[model samples]
Target: FAKFANVNDATSHWPTGEEVFTHLPGTHAHAPLIYVALMTFILIISSVTMVLAVEAGHRMDKKAVIKWMAWTVVGGLIFLGSQVWEWSTFIAGYDGDISTWADNGTLSHSPYGGQWVMGVDAHGHEVKQMVTYGPTLYANFFFFITGFHGFHVFTGVLFNFLVLRNVIRGVYHKRGHYEMVEKVGLYWHFVDLVWVFVFTFFYLV
Candidate 1:
């Protein structure tokens, strides 16, 4: 849907001369990209910690499992916090008008409204062009996709927390195996892998 929105004709959905579907506000300062990179780094590190925890579980090393699981939880938390910040920045826009409207819930006006550009025509005549920033569909897709993935991450974190609790209580130890840790680790790794695709399609493209 996002790809379709981006490539579809803008005459019916957006104003004329809209070259893109989403005009991320912080492109000049590279702020959005930096935040994305940071979040990706955090998730990658969390994946490593999960792997370590699983390895420790294989060896029945309770202390090592606790240590790595704790680190994984920390990493998940930081990634979530960073995602919140990024969402806030995206919604508010660099100018803050979108944030104001978002709070008011009034859609009569929007920051995506196009601006007039004065330039020379092909015939060297001065002409004024109405250049649209983008459409609101971008925001819709952004929130829906990222929020869906965020929920998955949240669930992964919750599951990890539960498994960690069980580990602390020696439940896995009593079972003579740590298969639960490995299971949760698989889920964590899947979540992290999904984020890589999301980041690539949403930001890199």
Candidate 2:
């Protein structure tokens, strides 16, 4: 394995790679596969339900459209809830988890108050061993990017609920347009798209 004294020396973080670097360290973290898998399924199913909603709208099946949208909204909300729980768990972790919540790192690896410990995995090492100071700047970056994604998920939950409320009131059905579903579908798909990058960066590469 090669080591870079500074992040700029790393190829993955380099400007030429900046296109993929858009998400940065977030794509590198040890993601929870179960969460990622479940989220993927939810997003795929949501898309399918959305398609059905549009078809039902075309057929003028107001009740059927409402039912499908309701399900989509439910899936989105559930995903959001799971994200919140994940964040909470990450923030509250102590033992092996990086305690970046305070930026003080007192909970895990705050060697110099603001400075966190950085560690490299030794031969045969399986866990993320920390340095006296944190897992280098990469871990910090990983947390920040994933935190942003989780925040997006959190906000998406609210948006999903709003659309669900409108659907329940038969707003889209009355308007004879399912653009609301389309809009939400766009956003949901975007989230899924982002996750695909996250999974590859964090879990695979």
Candidate 3:
């Protein structure tokens, strides 16, 4: 992972073992995996609530439909909030070594960016190791991909809210079919499915 050079490097054109930095920074205390799991759980619950809303619509139970749809909206909002927090943490990086650097007045930056380390070489001799915080492209990709998905979630929540309002207004009830609920439910489910892929690739992998 650390053997590859940056994509924009103008010097090296191949894996010459000269570049030992990764393209993505390592995880730190700020970005916990449990938070991601919680987000996933909330999204899954929201999807289930959407299903319940659709089912209630099928039975023409206006109150139940409204209730489930409201819960779904709440879940989506919570997930969006969580994503915002995650993005903030990622952007802020880790502060473990910041204080020390500040005290020295040399550099006051997160060590997650890059640093040197003392490690024993193959022959048990101490050596200075060069480490890097990873490529800027990783952050760009993280923001772009997750931000795109977050936009979808936001739109889904907005649509769900509108559908909920229509339900309360008896718009679907008058139509004698809850097809709108089902349609929005499909969109919500698709958003949830896309999140699963995003979570797996971005967080898990």
lDDT of 1 by residue, 1-205 (tens): 4573464344332321112223343453323355577789999999999999999999999989999999999999988887786677555443422221122122212334422223233221111112122244556567777898999999999999999999999999999999999999999999999999888776665
Candidate lDDT values, in order: 0.69, 0.55, 0.68
Ranking by TM-score: 1, 3, 2
lDDT (tens digit, per residue) of candidate 3 on 1-205: 1211233243221211112111123443333456677789999999999999999988999999999999999999999998887676555544533211111122223556544333233121111011122343444556777899999999999999999999999999999999999999999999999999877755554
What's the true lDDT of residue 11 in model 3?
A: 21
Clashing pairs in 1: none
Least well predicted 10-residue stretch by lDDT in candidate 2: 15-24
203 Cα displacement, candidate 2 (Å): 2.5
Note the clash tally of each candidate: 0, 10, 1
Q: Where is model 1 more than 4 Å wrong at Cα?
A: 1-32, 95-135
Say which candidate scores most in TM-score: 1
In lDDT terms, how accurate is model 3? Answer: 0.68
Using lDDT as the measure, which candidate wins? 1
